[model samples]
Target: MLFGAKNSSNPRLQLLKDVVLFKDLSMRELAMVDSLMHERRYLADEIIFDEGEEGQGLFVVLSGRVKIARFASPLEMLIELGPGAFFGEVALLDQSVRSAQARALEDVQIAVLFRAEFYSLLETHSAIASRISFQLARVLAARLRQAVANTDRHHEAA
Candidate 1:
């Protein structure tokens, strides 16, 4: 569980400008997104989400840092994202279990978009939805390439 203050004045729209995923969205489009998402805050070292848990939505970092990690023999870090970055996008396409766990490195703020609400937004606003879809696809493609490269490195070492 988590709790914090909510900023009602254009915080979401400003966040849209920070996130590359929403770089193409206009002020009006961002405002629409603002209306659809909810904001939350987490204390430092908080586990935002756990790996293998069902993903319910996407999250945009509004402030502070988050580390994405996976557990095997030991915990392996995937990445650390700061303000302006976003994650959990895979849930938007499919309600798949989360691949990595996210922990806040500092007291953090994030805007969350729930799956049901996002789907409704898509149905109501086709253009913004298309842009988000394209952005997610590109991000996934890049991650896949990185994964393949990492696999090759591990194979060569063995």
Candidate 2:
């Protein structure tokens, strides 16, 4: 519900620099991306986004913790994200239903990067966008590898 963090005195770019998605960006580039983002705050236990919802963008944690979970009958937790971490990254690339839900584990603040804004960046600043995209691909590939490894371990245990 919040828009850009320009009104706040806090250094948004400082937080942005630590985020993996923008790690390769310069201070100027990070400022450009920061201007495109809207800051949102969540209370403890609030759902940031729900499972099966149409993904629209990715959220980067600025402060506090978040839990990524598959809210099934058994409630399987996927991961816990903290400051400088990002989640819902796949949404930035395509329109798809989220496979997991993201919820605030504590009072949290985050910056959201919408897909439309990102696409515009791709058109106007391909260099910066491509850097982010490359990082995204690496993150996804690493997750895939970890998932496969977990599956193999489960199979061997069974």
lDDT of 2 by residue, 37-107 (tens): 88999999999999999999989999999999997889999899999999999999999999999999999
lDDT tens readout by residue for model 1, 65-88? 999999966899989999999999
Evaluate all candidate structures by whole-model CA lDDT and list the values in order: 0.87, 0.92
How high is the lDDT of residue 148 in model 1? 100
TM value for model 1: 0.88
Q: Cα RMSDs of all predictions? A: 3.8, 2.7
Q: Please identify model 2 stretches exceeding 4 Å from their true place.
A: 1-10
TM-score, per-candidate, Cα-based: 0.88, 0.92
**Model 1 regions lying over 4 Å from their true place:** 1-8
Error of 1 at 4 (Å): 14
